[model samples]
Target: MSRKEDGTLVLNKTKIFDTENCYIYQRGGTESKYWQFYYWDSEGREGFRIRKSLRTKDFLIAQSLAQREYINIRAKIQNEESLQTLTVAEMTNIFLAKKKLDISSVPHAGITPETYRILKNRCEKLNNFLGKDTRVDHLKRSAFKEYEQWRKDGYGGKVPKTKTTIKTELSTFKSIIQDIAIKDKRVISNAPDIPKITIPPSEDEHRRNHFRHEELRVLIGTINEWKEEKTLRKTAGLHRQMIACAIELMLNSGIRVGAVRKIRWRDIRVNPKDNPKQQKIFRIITIPSENNKTGKQYECNCEIALIVEHLKRISRFNSPSDLLFCNQNDGKTFSSRIWADCWNEIIKRSGLEEESGRRFSYYSLRHTYATVSLANKVPLQLLASNMDTGTKYIQDHYYHHETEELTEELNPIKRTRKMTADEMLAQYLPQKI
Candidate 1:
C-alpha cells in the first residue's frame, strides 16, 4: 500500500479512493479529483491515466468504471488488429502473383502461361459469380456448391462446364486461398473448413483418341498439300514443317507438345557408336529438367532418326540458339494461340474435322504415340520413361491390353497335362485306387 503527497491511499502509485483507483492531487491548497484514473504501469518507471471528469467528486466510482471500459476498449483493438481486411479479389491477386513467382523459379513446374490464363479466366468468373463486394471470410462451403450448380446450369453460355473443369477451377481457388492464409498470420482461419468441389462423372468414355495409320498418312498428305499450295498466309512453310515435325516426333518419341516446344538443338545427341554401313542408327533426345513437366530429365531413344535429321536440316538455316520450331514471320517462338490456329487450319484442310467431331491437335500426336507404343507391346516402365510422365498414368490412360505374358511363359508345362475328363474326375473323387 502506498499514498500520495495529498494523503490519499495508493496502490503501486495508483491512488485508491473509496476502493476505486484514481489520481488525486492538491491545487491552490484545495483537494480536488483529477477526474482520471492514473497509475505507474507494471514497470513502475512511468505513469499513465484515463480521465473521467474534472468536477467529479466521486473519484472511486469513476476510476472503477474507467478501468472496466479500458479493458473492453483494449479487447476491441486486439480483435480489430487480428482480422485481415482484404477482399477476395485482392487476396486472389496476391496469391496468384506469388504462385507465378514460385512456378517461375522451378525448373519444370508444369504451370504454363496458358494454364495461368485459364486460371485467371476462371477466377474472374468466380469473382463475378460471388459479386465484387464478397469478402474472403464470407466464402462458405455452400458457396462452392452453389458455384458448381451455377456452372452446371451454364452461367455464361453453352453447356455447363465439365466436372473435371469445375474441379480444376475449384482446386486453383482452394490452393490460392490456402497459400494466402498460411503466409499471412493475421488472416482469419477459414480455409480448412471449405469443402472441395466435387467432380461429376465424365460423359465421354475415352479421355483421348489415337490416330490410325491411314489417318496419319492422310493428315500428313493434306498438310503437305496445304504447304505446297501456299494456302497459309503468315507461316505457310514453317507451319507445314512444324506440323510434320510435331507428328513425326510424337509418332516416334511420344513427347508432349509443351516438351517439344522447349526442346533445343543441343539437347539432341546422335549415336556415333552404331555402324554406319548397316544403317543401324539411333538418336538420343534429352529432355532437360526445365523442359520436362515432372522436373525430371528423360533420355528418350529417338526411334525416327530421319525426323531428327530433318529438324537438324531446318536448324542449319535458322539461328542455332533459336527454338527448333520457330515462327516464320520474325523467326521467333510460336505462341500457344498461333499453335492452336495452325492446328485448326490443318484440321479444316484435312477434311477429318467432319468425321471426328473433335479435331486432332498437337496433343493428339502425343496420345497417338502412347497408344501406338502400347499396341507395339512397349514396356510400361519404358513408355513412362520416354514420355517423362509417371508409369501409373501411362497404365491408367493409354494401356488397355488384357493379355498376360505370364500365361505364355507357363504354357509349356500345361501342354503336357492332357488328362481326360474321367481321369481328372477319378483323381478328384476316388480315395481307393
Candidate 2:
C-alpha cells in the first residue's frame, strides 16, 4: 500500500455511512498498524475535525467502532456540546505540571510544595474513584455526590474517610475542575458543583502528633549514636550528619522541612552584640518568602548555630550558595525517599514509636516545638509569629498542652493538710450554719 502526502495509507480508506466527510483509514510510519477514523465537522465548528484510533485491526471491528464514534460525535454537535475531549487523568496531569512550574517560578504567589503534595494525593483519589479515562465534558454534578457516598462507604476498606477529610478532598477536586480544567485549559465547558459534606465535631482533640520531652531526648540521642556508627561509609556518615542537623534545626527553629531544604549558609547571621560561645541571641535564620510555607519572609532567633558550624566543618559543599541540607554526592537537597527513610529509621531506633504510641514524621518536630513553647508559657502571639502561623491555630490545636502544664493552677485543691473522713463529713453536714 502506498502512503499519501499526509502519511496516511490510502489502501485501507473506507467511507463510513456513505458520507463525504467521514472515513476510516490506517496511517503510515509508526501508526501504520492500528486503524483510525477521521470526521470533518463542517456543521459544528469551522474546519473542526476528529482523528482517533479505532484500536482494532479487523476491518469489521474497525468499521463498527468508527460508526459508533461518528454517531457520538454527531449527537454531541447536535446538542451544542464541546468537541474537545480530555480525560480526567490527562487534565490532572496538565494542571499539576503548570502548578509545579508556578511553584518554582513564582513561589511567593503559588502554593507550597507540601500543599501541592496534598493536592496531588487528592487528585489521585479522584482519578481512582471517578476513573482516569472518564472524559471531563461527560462528568455530571451527580458524580461528585456519588463520590461522597463512595468515600463514606469505607473507600473499599475497613476505615472510612472522616467528614473533614472528605470535605477537603471534594473541595480540592472541585477547584481543579473549575480553576484548571474549565477556566484555565478550557477543556470542559463548566464545572460541576460538589455536594457539601456535613462535618461533625471532631472527637480527636490532639490532631498534631508531637514528641514528649523524654521522647525528644531519646530521639536526639539516637540520632547522635546513628551518625557515630563506626561501620558507616564516609558518604553515609556525612548524610546521617546532615539528617541529624536537619532534625535539630527543626526542633530548635520550628521551620518546616520544605523551607529547611531551601536554606543556604548566607541565610544565617550571628548576633553582633551577643557572643557565640555564651549568648542569648545565638544566631538569626532568615527564612525567605520563596522558601517559607506561608510565603512570607521572617527571621527567627535560633540556638542551632553550633549545629550549623558542625555541618560546615563536615560538608565539602559549604559555600554560601549551596543548600544547607544536601546530598554529599551531588551537592543537591536530599531526595524525599532518603529523608523519609532516615527519619523512619531514627524513630524506630529511638524506641519513640512504641513508647510514645504515636506516628512520628519530620513534621512532628514542629508540633513538638509548638507544644513545648506553649508549656513554657511562650506568649501565644509571639509563638505564632515565630512559627509562621496564626495564634488561633495554636490555641485550637495546642492549647491542651498548655492546660496540662497548668494542671495544678487551673484546678487547685486547697488543703493545708490531709483531713480525716469525719472532718469531711462534718463540713458537709454543717455548711448552712
Candidate 3:
C-alpha cells in the first residue's frame, strides 16, 4: 500500500514497512503537515538514514533516494555499507584549494602561497593550543581571545601578536569553516562569529635602525681598506663592490632590496638620446609595473649613477639573464638572510657601533636616504614619487625634522663673543629703563 493511503502520522506515530529487504518509514501528520523519509537495515539493525524533516519527507522528491537505499540494503549488509564523513584536514585542504583558485583569477592577486602557509601555521598552532581531539565546532570567539593572550605572552620569541595578523589568520580560519558548511550541510547547525582584534598604537616612532653620515663614511673607508688588503685576495671582491653599490643605490633611489636585485640592464636608460653627453649620462632607472610592489613604474635619478657604474662592471662578467646581485655559491638571486649576514659582518668591521652607538642594516640605508633627502628640503611629493611609495607613508615613517635647523631658524642673533654675566644682564635689563 502507498504511504498516502496510510493513516495520518503525527509526532509520535510513524508509518513503517519492510520492503526490498529493508525497513522504510514515513513520518508526518496530515497532507498539510511536513513529512520525512527514513530507512533501516533489512536485519532490523541500526544504519545510516536521512533525518526526519521537511527536507526528506516529500515523497515526490525523496522517492528515488528511498528506493535506492532499500535496494542497497537488500544487496549488501548494513554494517558493510560505507558512510560519508568530513575531517578537519580534508576540509582545510578543500578550503585552501578554493582560495588558490580565487586568488589566481583576481586582477591583482596580492595573496601568495607563502601567505597561505603563514595562515595555515597559525591555524595549526591554534588547533594544537586547543588540544588534538578538538573539533571544528569547538572553535569559538572566546578561544581566540585566549590564543591572543598566549601570543602576547610570547609564544615563540615574537613580540605580542599584532591585531592585523590575528585578524587575517582568523579570517582564513572562518573561510575554512564556511567551506566545510557548504560541503556538509549538518555543519551549519553551529557556526561562531570571528572576534575582532584590537591594534594598540605603537609607542616608539623611530623603529628604523640606520647609519649616520659619519658612520657611513667610516663604513666606506673600511670597505676601501679591505679592498686594498692582500690577505683577503681569495675572497671575491664582488661582495665589497655589491655592498657599496647596494648602499649607494638605497641611499639615492630608496627602492627596496627586492627591486634592486631584480633590476635589468635595459631598465637603466638616459633621455635626450642624440646628445653625446646626455647619452652617456645615467638619468633614470625604470622599474616596470610588473616587478614593482605597487605594480607601478618608478624612475630614479642620476644620483643612482654610482649604482649604474657598478651594474655595468658586473654585467661585463655575466649575461643580461643573470641577476644584478647573485649568490656565488648557487648562482641565484641574493636572498634577504644572506644580505643580513653580510650587513652584520660589514658593521662589525666598520666600527660603526663604536662611533655612532647604532647598528645599521640595508633597510637603514634606505631610511637614512629618505631622512637626508628630507633634511635637504626636497619636496615631499617629489620624494614620494621617486620612492614608489605613498606620500603619507613617507611623511609618517621617514621624515624627521632636525632640531638644529629649527633652533637656528628661531634665533636670528649671532654673538661674536661671550659677554661677562654683568654685561649680559645690563644689556638685557637697561635698554628699556
Cα-based lDDT for every prediction: 0.64, 0.79, 0.60
True-structure lDDT of candidate 3: 0.60
User: Number of the top candidate by lDDT?
Assistant: 2
Scored by Cα lDDT, where does model 1 land?
A: 0.64
Model 1 lDDT at residue 237: 71
lDDT of 2: 0.79
Candidate 1 clash figure, as a count: 0
Ranking by TM-score: 2, 1, 3
* Global fold similarity of model 3 (TM-score): 0.58
Candidates 2 and 3, the one with greater lDDT: 2
- Cα deviation at 137, candidate 3, in Å, is 1.6
Rank list by lDDT: 2, 1, 3
- Any runs in candidate 3 off by more than 4 Å, and if so which? 1-88, 99-107, 110-117, 120-124, 131-133, 152-198, 203-244, 270-283, 311-317, 329-331, 335-365, 390-393, 414-433
TM-score of each: 0.63, 0.65, 0.58
lDDT of 1 by residue, 257-355 (tens): 878877777777766765674234567788877777777778887676777677667543345466677766666677877778778887788888577
The per-residue C-alpha lDDT of model 3 at residue 228 equals: 53
Off by over 4 Å in 1: 1-84, 105-114, 152-161, 181-188, 191-209, 212-237, 275-282, 309-319, 344-361, 379-385, 388-393, 402-433
Who is ahead in lDDT, 1 or 2? 2
